[model samples]
Target: MSFRNFTTGQSHGFGGTYLKLVPGEMLVYSDVFDDPNLPGEMTVTVRLTAVSVGTEMTVVQENVPDVIPVEACYLGWQDSLRKLAGLVEPEITG
Candidate 1:
């Protein structure tokens, strides 16, 4: 089994972005406006892997998406959020 974490964020004034973090010292996605005037919100996602070595478990591999669509306006916030979530959580498990 694999563990996954998904996140989403939004802002009204400037813009929005997305990020994802995973195991094995991997960074899913990251981006910055560099301009203070580009105020916005961002979301982060994380995934953890487990490895067994001599009765010890550790992270093996991870996959992180890219942080893009740095729109300066909150236009496709909802649709984008849902799309991101879908990518993060393709299936539901109990």
Candidate 2:
């Protein structure tokens, strides 16, 4: 997917292919950045498990480029997951 940062007016995108998928259980994918500066193929794995209250999800990313700090990548994932939760979780109304 492609994304443009409105604030910085900087744009970059990455393309990924699914390496493995197990329906609702797990998914593995590889991502390659469009920018040459970020030179590396990133492998992302996602796992889903059923719980009494709800589903639990885990994400793991490997082979991240040296240019990006680990903490920054983690923070980015946190923000993205928060946005995802907002979309998937239901609101309780009176």
Candidate 3:
């Protein structure tokens, strides 16, 4: 098992998009395995807690094995965003 802290955000109309991952909490780092009968991709889950607001977000990343080449790693990123969106809440700031 491994952990990583990844944060990403996007705003409409020139607000800009931010995406970054600090590898301080890497939970799993193993050498690439090459086997004839093994899974193609590995799923990684990471949970981050906001220091100031006590908010939590879960980030899921899929490590696509080079052995099994696919189209693109799109679904994995989308799953991460969907998990974070579930924990979003509105706050009053003045």
Candidate 4:
């Protein structure tokens, strides 16, 4: 699926198909952001582990453009995680 602005619902011009999926355990995919700020495709791998109390998640992004600052990706992923948690954690506990 393509990435879109949450507010505008417009395509961000970056899109890719899923490379691998394993139910709740793992997801790996290609994401290409064809913007002036970001000009490359990166492989994203998200792995999940079940814990006694909850779940553990790890996200690894590779082949990111050297021109892109790491801090930008950090902030972007942090925001995404917050949004994701809001969507999933409630159902896990509620």
TM-score of each: 0.21, 0.84, 0.27, 0.72
lDDT tens digits by residue: candidate 2, 6-94: 67897779998999999999999999999999898999999999999988989999999998899978887888899898998899899
Instruction: Evaluate residue 4 in candidate 2 and report its C-alpha lDDT on the 0 to 100 scale.
Output: 69
Error of 2 at 76 (Å): 1.5
Each candidate: what lDDT? 0.38, 0.91, 0.46, 0.83
- lDDT tens digits by residue: candidate 3, 1-94: 2223345352211111123445643343222233434344355555566668664656554665664345434554566578776788565599
Candidate 1: misplaced stretches above 4 Å?
1-75
Off by over 4 Å in 3: 1-63, 67-72, 91-94
Against the true structure, candidate 3 reaches a TM-score of 0.27
Candidate 2: the clashing residue pairs are none
Model 1 C-alpha lDDT per residue in residues 9-67, reported as the tens digit of each score:
44323223435444454444333344455333333333444446422222221221224
Instruction: In angstroms, give how far residue 5 of model 4 lies from its true place.
Output: 9.2
Top TM-score model = 2
- lDDT of the structure predicted as candidate 3: 0.46
Better of 3 and 4 by lDDT: 4
- Colliding residue pairs in candidate 3: 2-27, 2-28, 3-27
User: For candidate 1, what is the TM-score?
Assistant: 0.21
